[model samples]
Target: MTLSNPADGRDDPYLWLEEIDGERAVAWVDAQNTRTDGFLVDESYQRDFDAVLKILDADDRIPFVGKSGDYLYNFWKDAEHPRGLWRRTTLESYRKDKPDWDVLLDIDALNKAEGISWAFAGAARSPDKTRALVSLSFNGTDAIEVREFDIATKSFVTDGFVIPKAKTQVSWVDDNTLLVGSAQTPDDSTEAGYTRTVKRWTRGTPLTAAETVFEVEKQDVAAWFGVNRRPGHEGLMFWRALDFTRSQIFVERKHGPHAGQRLQLELPEEISVGAEASDLLISPKQDWTVGDLTIPAGGLAVIDLASFLSGARDFDIVFKPTPERALQSWAETRHGIVLELLDNVRGRLSLLRRSEAGWRETPLPGLPDNATISAQNFGGEDDPKLGEDVLFTITGFTRPTTTALWNGRSAPEKLKSAPRNFDPEGIEVQQRHAVAEDGTKIPYFLIGKNLSMATAPRPTILYGYGGFEVSLTPSYMAIAGKLWLEHGHAYAIANIRGGGEFGPSWHLASRKNTKHVAHDDFAAVARDLANSGVTTATKLACHGGSNGGLLVGNMLTRYPNLFGAIWCSVPLLDMARYTKLLAGQSWIAEYGDPEIPDEWAYLQKFSPYHLAKAGQNYPPILITTNRTDDRVHPGHARKMVARLQELGCPAWFNETVAGGHSGAVDNSKQAQSQALGYAFLRRTIAK
Candidate 1:
């Protein structure tokens, strides 16, 4: 069988069905940095049983990308190796007395070796460098635990922490206080939903004294107790909320009875919100949007909460107007916030930081190669070509991660993840709509090497995450291009409802009782592709991680035959006991509260754990999660697999020792995991 590029405009689509599955698995990487290679992708690089835990710790410093600058910050802790979990300083709260720098949080600590138990997935010191929040999974009944740490004291308060019936969410309002947003847990309640809210906590209060700040009243934030992985925890939980639609800044009154209290902070209908809190720039226009919506997400503007929410009207709009560019980073230097933008998506270094008074744009440094980039892994890449600048893997459709950097200079690199084996000389990536049964035009990204009937039914894979308000964007991905498309595969990214693709509203469309919309959107895409003659169900596969994993699990139950194989990673399938599982108690906001009889009635209808039929003939499923997954309990997978097996369902389940929500502690280990995933995909679909 001869495989040709399908997008040559010949309308040829059906090509891969006749081709042998294992002969090769086609993967097309979008340009270079448009997609990223998730986990490690090497198959034969398997670690020995003893070496498994050791290898996962290799990529410890997988850096984070800083705003407005090229600097990346990454952290790694290895208990097996000499670089023990405690890299250096002693935490003040962990100290027996008022912390002295010399006094170790556990000077003669018993659990010192397993201290950093999990990845840096928990809270850390805020920009003020005053305090930090770290969550860890403990053995026995201690499913997961949170620590209110004091950076100044190098100690952490072990008590007074909130422990959910399942999981607890901590957002620091300031060094002295933090908010624990958790779903209500009932004596008879059961459902691993990301609904509900509140669980107010403070340092001196007894753990039992934690109070409820506010319950989300369950609207669609899709953030289940911070279940899904998205962006740095640095400030996601800002002390305030904004009128995302009208660009109205709703500030929590720092005075009065509500002094320093975290508020729901609703926004007017015409404001828009940038994904990040720092990027929550308010524009002057009453209505604006990114490219699709008509809200207040224009270039950038500054807003004050006291003026809007309090009706003070004390400030005007032009406090600081962002230039005609994306404000990539902002710095609170001696003068004011230094707004930096990378005007040219292709260049290394930023054009300049235009001062409020039109200051000269300072040149960012350059891109660093081999930079371990992630939403959280900040720091520089490993490449010298990028000198000392912040590194980014930038490319799309055809380009790869080109290196650049910023050493306090201006040059920065936009190219981060570039491809090596496959060439994107003629591939194409386009955005299209997959209309839902309810008349909603859900957007999805389609990528193919040759997309016509002559290239018809080419092997395809679709990915999604419709639960959390997490908007799927293009980033550098190397392995997908290498195996899935570069070899002649077509893939789709469904940006369905239950996601923040269009701000909070999009997610609301499919959260809680409306979660069916997410599954429907996924099925609709698969059906669209099959009916449109792009690919048939036999040649298609579906994948999702975290909440998206739940997407896959739900798909199998409702639309059993839509996919050939399902790769559900770190998924929460058992909704009933989820809130009752390790850390499961935290995510009531996204799913729903099962404690209340009415919420439980609705929750039971959609809860996968309760709804999984006994004799259903579901498709083959491959599930993965971290054993030390303090975020989404591994028990979700354990119980799920056990139930499936007992009920005579074909299930493949694997649990990594650590890596928070995701698995494969390091790149080498990550590669092995990827290889295993690829192998599983091939076994079910390609084979």
Candidate 2:
């Protein structure tokens, strides 16, 4: 089969590669895998693979647990149980060095018994906690089969709820009723291949006979259903995600004179909603005006749920955004809410409680500052004893992660800590600034043993992802620490404008028609590293995956003279056809619709597949992806490599058969894929 570029009406020679499982494509992939193995996997490569795998499979690694009734549940995987074991233990036992865990499910044993490869996706427990809806993904794809399991028997319930694999979403309304949405074809799904409608399914009834509760437009992203069973605030909720950054919320009355009636919320599409006790929490991405009052963008405000539903316009602003400080996330406890804030790219935590007067805010005490802090609603919100439990994880570039719990009163108590996976002895982390063409100062974190160029420059890897409003903060680089940093090389994370480091405005400044500003910011950082003499162009390597893959793809094609090697993984390279592939349609709000002539004019400028030329001085690049990556189609990587190779440029390709968009299923596979990328960097730039 042959395909042609819609933009220029030119025949596309590598278009057949887009046939995911076609015999010709499979043969080509097998040959490419063998060739990549011959080029990368040597004695030295084995050493790199072993080091990464050991760290991944280490027994002493911290086991993170979440509360569910009487047990703290955890899913564990190691060399012994490569597929993993779902287990649980008591809080007292979890506090001990060696917890006495009770195994609930053995994935490897189940796979062997069924003669199939299935990865444990996750489990959603019922409110009673006696049963759970277990999701298993076949071959590591996003599509999953959900089965009901009994906690006591530790087995799937006979004749219980079972959903065949598709992009399924399940939420339990009670033990016998569920709000389900599943799609297996375009007729039942949105343009992005996600469930387009939600239905009410009762026990013992065929799913096809379930009552339709809500439906969304085929052009919209998707519709999701949720149940809010918070004491007196019980109701059914539905939300339509119009795009990545816009949504409309709805609430259905479960009990009352208005039972069975759904009410569309009076809210801006850009505003997000949450609930705690009897109060309604809202955060607007754009400034919102209610009556004569205005709440600035990125501010957190609250109003009584009863009053809000009754058309009351009284709202109390809890947290207002500053130029440097913005609300990152928040979690609810019994008596208060824990706020995660970002101050100039650093993490900060605050606690807010209700008083007779109004809301009172205080700084959370005894937690590390200048690090990434994630808080979750631990111990179910309704638990009588552990209702106020908030679990927090704290870590930095060199700091090993530590889990702590705050009981809504005292300082957080450290529960468990991770062992030092890599040697951090002579290393230092520094935050540097790069001045872009628009005079924007981009902040980046540089980690290295030494940052001097007095004698000679050192090899370095610069990484970035500048879209989707995703913030790239400080993180413990265990794999890189073992393979790259331990070798005395440097690593830097670029906090460019397209990220949420500075909140919504930061992201909006560099997206859509102005997306080139993000690539410009990344190039500015690359130049800053060289101008500072930290590394020369020939010794610098750039790496990014997914959306970040597109970042380095631009660096490879648009700024080839600045880097020695590029590692792009699971990327969206062929912008012209991206929207038509898998879930790519959902991201049109981010990249613009190429079907529109005006949009295509600008999109082509950033498309790496179209930018390749025969005589251009392109640097060596390794494009890697997974065959089962149903998110960003592998055709992006396949076609780009073919185009570059045909143009006589140095390019290599490697793809694994399993492992979704992340490109790995198990730790061993993850280590192998990672080792291949690091080996390519070592071979090309780390002389």
Candidate 3:
């Protein structure tokens, strides 16, 4: 029942906050409430802001692994702390300091700050935590750059195989070899995308001696990699494809030059991976490993670890209630899975143990149903059970994320909540679905209050991201929900088909030549809004980042009259030129192989760059791009803005000097972004 201001941390009675890491916890808080108008939640906390917050208080010596910032992905001593050290920490300092620690990776000389130096992925060490294999990114001709940094010494040792594309996460089978996957960079001119490659890397000299053990054909290359899974079952290898349908499990030999080369098995037939947490986990030195494996059919499949290595094994299916049609976050323990389930439209934590007696499902003793749980990635020195305990954050649909701790042994401890200036009861959000031109159903969430621009048109903001099988679910948005919902009460989110809403099938149905289906779906939604009495072209606004930006670009070209303003953030707008840009070649699977005539024909039909015309009635667009966006280059936003300006269109361009994809680095900056976005929308539509 305590309220506080975010700026001074002063106890204010105006705002209610549920402290997740501290004793004080507020029930309902929303970012949209920060504005004058906003969204709402049920008093029962049954359906509301569905964000996550976790709290733990076992040890004061260390910080809980905080959420990653763009520039400082590893510098989160905490994001919720009113005063935390993570804010001052930079990527350079983190890369410089960690080497002094015990068994830190030595990577100064070879792993340049200017050059690529990402942390290795899927390096499962022995039970003793002694030796580990490293896989990092290096830039080459066809491929940009990536290098492996030893976790123990923080040092770089060797070069990697030349992939015509970029690679992600290196999965280690032993101390010496790694499962390396490569993605082709895009062809900037013709919009050609390179096919992705998957192979193995052994301790050896670069290119001269590096070896490849597995290579998929060009025919089936959508170029996306999945989370590496190492089950307790011997020889059983599981990976969840990033751009595909199901989680494929393979069995290979444990030792040999050809080890892990052949795929002897695939499992969970008829099971397509769905919109779930990044729960593909590998146990360290355990005989049995549990993966929070999701099937498109809904729920989790706790498959038996012995099924891959042994002849017959028992597999269990845990369909934790997902009443909100939202995603679930779970952590694996030798004991079982600590599932942070979503119920009542908020987040809750429960422990499901895999014991000799079968499975044990228990909720955290004292934490209320309104509490939400977040899984900390980096290790902290709290109770071993503290690590096992799922962190829960509780807030109404109008709540900001807070932290809390729930070790299996004890009840729950509260932590700090979001700034008090924010309020949820001030706004209201409604989830609505609209049908597309192809009879495709598109789901969108609309948040607003006193919700109309009767005298004038109210500013309406819309956001969407529909690619890579990633679904944009309706959650407690710190800024979008607050700024747009509260201040303007005119914001909407369209869950288009390119996302993993229905399943992998939903994603694939909108890929390649059919990619226009996604754009069509978005436009259909926009058209519905204009026709539905929500708003019209002169007051309607659109926003999307990454792939969704591409969608926005198409909407501008195809149905230019449907919207008045556009906010394209770090978008992939130049489809014809995308495959030619840095790392652009890796996306052939999603956008289609532009090099081929057939694919080109299809892509040209909807590629935003090809569609941008001099006489086109383009919407007023504010294009935001990043200079150091290692993943999606800022060139996209830049080129599109330049094109619009050249065509005499009103284009406002903002190039983030630093930070990768997101222009902002910290929560404060992000909040400022919210203010700016809301202000922009208000200026354009809300009068």
Best of the candidates, lDDT:
2
List TM-score per model, in order.
0.58, 0.97, 0.63
Sorted on lDDT, highest at the top, how do the candidates line up?
A: 2, 1, 3
TM-score for candidate 2, residues paired by index: 0.97
Which is better, 1 or 2, measured by lDDT? 2
User: What does candidate 3's lDDT look like per residue over 123-211, in tens digits?
Assistant: 33322233333333221112233444443444443452222324343444555555555453331111223333455566664432445
Q: Candidate 2 — worst ten consecutive residues by lDDT sum? A: 1-10
Candidate 1 residues 1-687, lDDT tens each?
222222121331222211212132112111111121222233422422223334334332222223212212223344443222322222222122222222223311425655643323344444244455655544211234666566456666556344544444556555566666544454211233433455556768764577754443223332222211122212223222111122222233334344455454454444333322222344323343333433333334444443334443322222222222223333322222334432211222233233557535443343332122221112212221222333344444344544433344444423232224356655677667778898877777777776633665766788998876666655444566655676677888887888655544566677678887888998998888888777788778899988888888888778888777778887887665556554455466567656655556666565565456787877777777665555676656655655666678877766555455655343444555566676666667776
Candidate 2 backbone collisions, by pair: none
lDDT, candidate 3, at 322: 39
Deviation from native of the Cα of residue 540 in model 2, angstroms: 0.9
Please give the RMSD of candidate 2 to the true structure. Answer: 2.4
Total backbone collisions, model 1 = 135
Candidates 2 and 3, the one with greater TM-score: 2
